[model samples]
Target chain A: MIHAIRARIKQGHRTTRYPDEPMTLPERFRGYPRLDAGACQDGCTKCAEACPFGAISCKPSLSLDMGKCLFCTNCIEACPKGAITFTNDGRLAANTRDGLVVGPDTERVLARALDNKMLSLFGRSMKFREVSAGGCNACEADTNVLSTIGWDLGRFGISFVASPRHADGLWVTGPVSGNMLEALRLTYEAIPAPKLVVACGACAINGGPYIGSPDVCDGVDWTLPVDLYIPGCPPHPLTILDGLLRLLGRIPEK
Target chain B: MTSTMRTFRNGSALPLGDVPVLETESFLKAILDATVHGWRVSSYFGLPRGGGLRIYCLMSSDSRGSLGMAAADVAGNAFPSIAEFCPQIQMFEREVAEQFGVVFEDSPWPKPVRFERRLTDRTAAGCRTGRPSDVGVMEYYQVKGHEVHEVAVGPVHAGIIEPGHFRFQCYGEQVLHLEISLGYQHRGVERLVLGGPHPASLHQMETVAGDTTIGHGLAYAMVIEALSGTMAPARAHALRGVALELERLANHTGDLGAIAGDVGYLPTASFCGRIRGDFLNMTAELCGSRFGRGMVVPGGVGFDCGPELAETLLKKSAAARTDLANAVELLWETPSVMARLENTGPLTAEAARELGLVGPAARACGVNMDVRRDHTFGIYSMAQIPVATASTGDVHARTLVRWLEAEKSLYFIDEQLRHLPGGACMGKSNGLAGEHIAVALTEGWRGEVCHVAVTDDAGRFARYKVVDPSFHNWPGLAMALRGQQISDFPLCNKSFNLSYCGFDL
Candidate 1:
């Protein structure tokens, strides 16, 4: 007990003051992409050509899909005019799938808050049933990290429930694998009506790197209605929280 | 029938013709002969070759520090089964049968490995009809008698873990037999990787098993580099070493914490999870992603650890080491934690060897075969990290082994950062040689991650096979459940936290 007490003292208070204050991510941590069409020169398709997942389109004007991007920095690395640049800002979640597609003038694609009725249902407290359809476990892990002392997501009345029956919504990760597709449907059906769904990664949003794999669906939206789309290879824990908070109307709209 | 098998070093490529193409009789005999002399099957898969199927077998000889490779052309289903004789090859053979739609005459369990659509044309594009049938519906081994009940758990579990079905035949509280059926996470990596894995290959590889981003990423990178005759710069290798160790630190720390939490020890669980995140942040400091996703590229690392970054990492590593020791040592000091962990979910050393377990689990059972130490690759060849092992094959031994390895990983990171080579970290990988086969193995935190790539005439990936550590260790988990109380299943499962997607891939 002495040892335990000493350890707790050393651990201290780790929960970060995120959403209130901006989460401090590393410099190298590429998040929301800032695209400047003015910066782009004519006939420049380096960014598009460099993109592996076709996350970028450089036809008439350059548009980037946050849902489809892995943030590998190939577009930025290959862009000669510096038209596309990734910022340290980690908040890159959106409410609508179309909102994830950012044009040159776009800034942060933050998730829009839910309507008053929906907010009344889940704004104060929301329990999510995490479903890993075909997730690589990275998204599942980052979601778990939120429950730890560092993130303390439960402070905001947010948590992952053990059963779909008890959950307010489903927090889905991974491009839905075929075998899991059936199970995911069953789990979703088990949840009550008017349930929300948050696709928590690029895989869940647009299949990330596995967009065309026959064994997996394109994304979570293929099978279920996603209320919020958090995008990344595995979105940073802070990014995930931002999406959830914004969706619940907990984080006030700018 | 050729008796000679082409022996190659880890992450090295060999000409397709250089590998001994033996008759089925000779191939079986060769695999059997080598296993008798302590050789283990590292990778074995069937490939569609010229109107017939060819089975390629790779055997790892730890003592010799080389992998023996051989191939046999089976005309039809005429290939005899060797899994009944060698239990180690059981999973690989079963996988081969599942993938190619061939029958293994005497396979102990010829069940679906990942439930991915077989390569056969009939089931190819299983999702073409826009309906995927439910997996894990196969018949499970039963213990038929009164007082013997069956408990089926998950493709969707109570926790946030990935999907995998576990069937436990329990007599009262004690588990009689545990059979695991997986493949809910299968995203069909092997099928997708065929043809040309152009620009998306690296990202796809990184997600092969997402938590093991560094492990699978590095293995895929090595395979590409080997096939293309590319050598990463000295600095890149050292940086990769740093990233790999950080991944190990993060996972091992998290697993230790999870183990403690399962046993109702909150102090260690609460602190270690945070400490694990710290290690992940360190990796993010090196690269952009916490999982070290973009850090490793084919030719070299996409990101480099400069002097300033290295210094910061070193400081963080030292801090996390101290923090980890403080949190974890309580588990050792407390009687309850120790009692619960020791002898609970015990797997005998013999069982571990027979099942061919790898990584910390194998080390816990005193089977010392780490890819880093045994079949050294990357910067491991330069600075050897000593293999951590324990004699007891229980939850306690597994936990302690992780602790020891976590210490070693921190030390290794410290050493690498202090003396990181100052040079270019990125290079160009040459075009892959057209008719070549490459094999790469990396000891991920979980265990050995094996990637075998065979190129077509145009130097594109024709057959890409991945054997995640979970493939070798999942059976070990089932074996560990035997005679254990059903309540302790969570603790035992946590002890060997195998990757679902990696195995499903």
Candidate 2:
């Protein structure tokens, strides 16, 4: 056991120095959805059809509501432009509600607007209790890995609690199910006031392939109001790590 | 014994019995009688376009492997019920009744068995009334006792796991009866296999259950190959075996880590998790998928096992084996883990047999059944593997079995790679005509994965039935949970690692 611990320590710091330097993501990590207008046809509506969360729309032109987006990458995957690159640049936040927008090519426009919003501010910490509505456990695996000895996310005062009652934030993943709808409501109600709900992964933000299932609900927002949405099929561990830090106000809004 | 393939060239056979083609009532009785005689019903075939509802029952000991065939014309009978003899058939029968309205006489439980009853009503807007009926409302057993409070846990849980609901009838933590409700992760994969794409689109068949991708993919490819009389090249076959063994090793290592973690053995969990990560990284190096994706394509592999990837895999496997051995040894020194897992969730030999449990779950209980060893497929026949088994059916035994098997898989992969012949990796996969029905059974990490597929005149998928290992082992879970404390549930549950999505679909 001592040898194993020594081996891990000898491997050096495997954790990313996120606050000090830019974090490098894996090659194929699902970060956020990007819109490619050039590759999309004038009324193809493929993106909208592909979205289980109704995250994409083409009525007035392409529009995306990141708040509602599940980050499933299905829209980007279906986009013929070779247009979408899985980039890990989600640092968008706002004090006012109107900052959220929707429309075709909005991701490109928001990309520039959010660039200045990455303000690096540190503040109070909060506890998160994760729930897998109907996830494949990929996101859950990544969630647990973030808190290992290396990342030491607890140092940021960002911790995953065992129960929702003591939690300041409810971290939800997977597509909500018909049977779980009641349990979800009870959990949200059990938590104290000033509580927040963050929908993680494509399944939680949107149903993904399980959208039309008779057993599952649409998404977290469809059941309860969501405070933040981190989209990805199974978002990269670093993406989730960053998202949680941002929620705690420790991450700066650049 | 050599088995000859039954050529269903004209039309696939249905359950055979006395029935007026138009009368749904007598037809239902005929099918029920067949099922009661120990006949394993394979697939339920419904042709809304052809005004047909059929159940194909294949008798295992029958001559020429003939499938007793029977059909009920739903156009003549509005409702059909066959829930009495084969209660399990309610799902399929109700599906047919909701969609096609073939009424069966004297069904013990008669209600819409698949869809929402009110919505599936014949006059509902845009609802397809030509298919079977909807799902019936779930019935709860009545108990006369002290209040009998019910506590429901999940669709979502506090831990890192899939969605499933455990409704416990308890009196202050001491549970009375535990009822499990699942299906939260249903993705309609079987329906996706039909109409919208060609049979070649079966490439995604592996991804249905991400962790068991290689196993399912191999089974799907084998079914296609069997139907079309195609054989993958020797090199591809070797590569497939290599992928399968790697998959088994990765899963077993990770599961062993989790099992240790559940008992609060952090040293083993941390070390094994890291080792398992190395295994996954090796997989990513070999195939684009970190979880063995795109390794098994129909007819053969899409990519060859190049020297560089094979060499990298070999090095990684060696390192993983060394790390795991040392970690497990350290874990053995810790008495706390042993105290928690040693004799928990014991499944005796008799109970194991009665439940028909397969793979590691059965092996851990001394049943000694493994599809790879019993009825070999791919290169396993040539690999000449001895079945892994343990007499004690506890969590500890399962963990030991996994550890032992991980080493075996690593050995198998090394042997396969060394003797891998130099040759082509693919073959022709075209011309799937006649009533081509084929089945492929493989030993996935979980257990036996059986896939049966039938092609129509136009070569479209007439019916496809996928049976994951979880289907048979789920009953085993209910048995294992018996007389055990609620806290031990996680340890017992992790021992099986049953895939929720695999069974949901």
Candidate 3:
């Protein structure tokens, strides 16, 4: 016990001061994509051609669906005109499905908090049950990282419940594989009424890399009525936390 | 026995016609002879050919540090099962049966590996059997005795983990049998990569098991490189080595913490948890994403590590090493933690060998096999990291082996960063050569990740096979559970921590 205490003391505090104080992520850390449609050379479709998933649409002015983007910067690299760039603005989440799509003129989409009813009910404490439909475990790992000492998501009274009965919503991850379809639905059904669904990661939002694969149901939107959409190949824990807080009206909307 | 077995180096791409496609009897005989003479089946899959299924077996001879490829045409959708003689190929046989409708005659537990939908549709050109059904609903081996209670847990588990069903047949508290039923996370990864290396193929490989992005990505890149006959730049090789080791460092650190958490050892659990993130952040510092996702690409790495970044990484890794040592040392010193880990979920060396377990799980049983050392490739061929092993095949042994391996990986990453080669990180990958079969192997944090690609006459992927270490070690996890307490299941499970999706894919 003494040794344990000493070790703890030697380690010191390792938690990040996010929301309270600005957290400085690595400069290379990719988050929201910034698109400059005016810069596109005439008849150039390099960005769209470069995208593994058809996340970028260039026929009409530049538009990128965050839900479909892997943030791999393939589009940026392929763009000969420098029309696309990834800004380290990790605050990319939304309440509606269509809101995740960024038009050329739109600066960025910030996740809006729930309406008055949900805000009053779940603003203080929101418990979620994470269901990994077919996630590669990256999203699941990042989601679990929220509970670690560094993140301490519990400070906001947000916690991942063991059972659906104890949850206010379902935190869905993965591409919702055909095999896991029934279980994922059953898990959502087990949650109490007035429950919200937060689709986490690119797979849960738009099937991510496995978008057109016949084995997956594309995203959680196909199964459940998602209340919030957090986008990333596997959304950073900070992004997930920010999204959750924004949904609860704990963090101010941009 | 060695005379008949055709051999190739680790990353060599051979003409498809050159691989010996012997008679069914000779193929089976060759495989059996090779196995008896100390070789292990690396990959076994079926490729559709002229309205028939061609079964290919890639065997690795660890002693010779060479790989052998052999094939046989399945006559009328049925082939004799060599699984009974060589238990290691049991899962592979089951996979071939399910995927291509080839019957493994007289094989034990001949059931669908991943109760996948559209097996008939996918295998329409070849032999087809087994209709799609609900996942995890299969005939499981039951224990029949007084007070033998059966407990089924998950396809939806309690923790924030991937889904898989675990059924325990217990006599009171002690488990008589434990059968793991997976396929919940199957997304048809193998079928998706057929025909050509689509723009999405690299991304698919990276997410084959999200945590194993570097390992799988490296294997896929090597596949493309071998087929295209393009070698990555020296700097790229050095960068890949760094990324692979960083991935190992992150995961092994996380697993150590998870093991501690399973045993309810809080201090080490909390500290290691944060420390694991520190390693991940170092990786993020390398290529942006914490998981090292976009870092590795075909022909070379996506990102370059310059001198300044290398210095930062070196310093961060040093601090992480200190933090990790301080945190994990608690696991060894704490008597309560040791009591839960030591001798819990023990699998004997013979069982591990028979099951063909890989990675730390195999090393825990003192099998002494690491692809980096045994089947050398890339930077590993130039600089070797010592394989760490422990005689006790218990949970403690697995934990200790991981700790030791993490230490070695830290040393490797530090060395590579200090002496990073100077050059362009990527080389131009040309169109693949026609009628070629290439095999690429990487030592992922979990174990040996093997990817084999057979190109058609048009230089497109005819058949691509991925063998994640989880495919081999999941059986070892089941074996480890035998005669152990049911309550200790989580700890034992954590000790192995096999990938469900990787196996499902």
Candidate 4:
């Protein structure tokens, strides 16, 4: 008991005050991206060719699909003119799939509030059933990290419930492998109507690494409509939180 | 080890022709002989050919400090099952049978392992085989009696975990038998990497078990490097070592906390949970991904660390170390935790060995089989992390082994960071040597991550087999459940915490 108390004292109050306060991410942490399509000298498709998943294309106009991006520096490394770079800002979520697409025109497409009914229903307290369709456990791990002492996502009145029947919506990740599609559908069906579907990670938004494989159906969006798309290989906890908070109209729209 | 087999060290490439294609009897004999001679079966899988399949078995010996390889080209679909004599190869043979449609005659568990065959292949093989349409749909072994009941749980579990089904044969509160059905997470990784070293190969490796990014990633990278006839620079080795150990620290801390959580202990669980994130953030500090994705690249690492970052890691790791010690010690100090932990799910050393368990579970049973020390790869070749072991194979033993390994890993990380080698972290890659087989083994946080890459004539991958530690340890988990209280399932399961996706892959 004494040891527990002492340990608790030493590990005192480690939760972050983000959204209200400025989030301090690592220097090397690749989050939101910056693209300078105009900087290309001639027909430079280096970034597009360099990308493993074809997330980048520079034919008529250079554009990046944030949903398909793995956040790897392959594109940035391949670009000789230094036209592409990833910013430390991790707010790369959007309400629509097109919103996740970035070109010279699209500076940033952030997630917006769900309709007033959603705000009235789930703005205060929301329970979700997280389904790892074909997830690589990273998304699942980071999602679980939210419930830990530091993040304590439950403090925001957002919690992952045991059953989909009790959940307000579905939180999906991975490329949605064929074997898991039935289970995911059954889970999504179990939740009450007017439910939210938030797809986290590149896999959940677009088939991240396992794209084009016959084993997986593209993503959760292939079968079910995704209300919010948080794009990262596995989105950082802050990114996930920001997406959640933004959906609830909690954060002041920038 | 044998006249028919060819031996090579880990991370070393051998010409594929050097491995003698023995007759079926000799192949089985060589494998059984190698096992009797104290070599562990690292990887055994059948590669598909025209009509039949070629069976290859790779074994590693800690005492002899070598890896041996031998193959047999089966003319037709059938191969005589040695899984009857060697229970260790049961899962591998089952996997072979499922993937290539080869029938392993006279096996104990003749069921499909991970349901690797596609519907088209299943139909093409023979529709009359009557295979299940989907993964996890198989005939489960039933224990029938007057008061017997079966409890079937999940492909969709309660927790935020990958999917797998578990059927428990129960007599009231006591579980008589437990069978785990998986393959929900199979994305055809081995099949996907069949052609050239596709751009998605490294990405696939990183997520083979995302928590084990450093482990599997390192193994895959090492295989690529060996094929290219190059070694990652010393500095890269140092950084990879640090990343690998950090991964160990993060996962072991999480497992320790989870074990504590299972016993209803809150303080340690809560503290270690945050500390676990701290380690992950440190990994994020390395290559931006908390899970170490895109960190381990072929020929070297993707990122480099300067002195400033090394010092930062040193300080951060020290802080995590202190917090981890404080938090974990509470579990030891707490009598309730200890009472709940000790002798709850016991596996004898013999059972662990027979079942071919690896990683912490095998170590807890006093199997001194850490690939880092035994089959020394890049950084482990230079410096050694002592194999942590415990004699009593129980939840308490597993927990103790994990905690001990965590401390060692912390020390290792500190040592590697402080002495960060000078020079380039990345290296120039030469073209891959054709018709070569390289067996790369890494000591992942879970266990030995063995990746065997065989290059075709045009310097492309003929076959790539990844044997994640979960493949070896899942059966041990089943054995651990025998005759234990059904309520203790969570505690016992947490103790092993094997990767479902890694196993399925």
Q: lDDT tens string, model 3, A178-204?
A: 888888889999999999999999999
* Fnat, 2 decimals, each candidate: 0.84, 0.23, 0.72, 0.66
For candidate 2, give the lDDT of residue A250.
Answer: 60
By descending DockQ, how would the candidates be arranged?
A: 1, 3, 4, 2
Considering just the first chain, candidate 4 attains a TM-score of 0.98
Give the range where candidate 2 chain B is weakest over 10 consecutive residues by summed lDDT.
B1-10
Highest DockQ model number: 1
lDDT of 4 by residue, B186-278 (tens): 777887788769888999999989899999999999999999988689999999999999999999999999888889999999999999999
Query: lDDT score of model 2?
Result: 0.62
Per-residue C-alpha lDDT of model 2 across residues A1-254, encoded as one tens digit per residue: 56657655644444558767876543433344455556666668876776545666676666666545534345765666654444456443322223334443453322111122222221345677877665655556657666765466877867788777878768787676444455567778887776778777656775654554444565777667776666554555656766666655565545
- Please identify model 4 stretches exceeding 4 Å from their true place: B118-133
Q: Who is ahead in TM-score, 2 or 3?
A: 3
TM-score of 2: 0.74
Q: Model 4 misses residue B336 by how many Å? A: 0.4
* Candidate 4 residue B21 C-alpha distance from true site, Å: 1.1
Off by over 4 Å in 2: A1-124, A148-152, A177-182, A210-231, A246-254, B1-52, B57-137, B141-152, B169-176, B196-207, B224-236, B293-295, B302-305, B381-385, B416-434
Q: For model 3, how does the per-residue alpha-carbon lDDT over B1-505 read when each residue is reduced to its tens digit?
A: 4566568999889988888888999999999988888788899998888889899999998888989988899999799998888989999999988887788889987977888753436543211112334788779999898888999999888999999998999999999999889999998898888887999999999999999999999999999999998989999998999999999999999999999999999998899889999988998998999989889888898888888899999999999999999999988999999999999999888888788888899999988899999999899988899999999999999999999999999999989998988879999889999899999999999999999999999999888999999999998999888889999999999999999999998
Model 1: per-residue lDDT, tens digit, B245-351? 99999999999999999999999999998999999999899888999988999889988877898889889988999999999999999999999999988888788
C-alpha displacement of A243 in model 1, angstroms? 1.3
Task: Evaluate candidate 2 and give its CAPRI docking class based on DockQ.
Answer: incorrect
Error of 4 at B304 (Å): 0.9
- Number of the candidate with higher lDDT, 2 or 3: 3
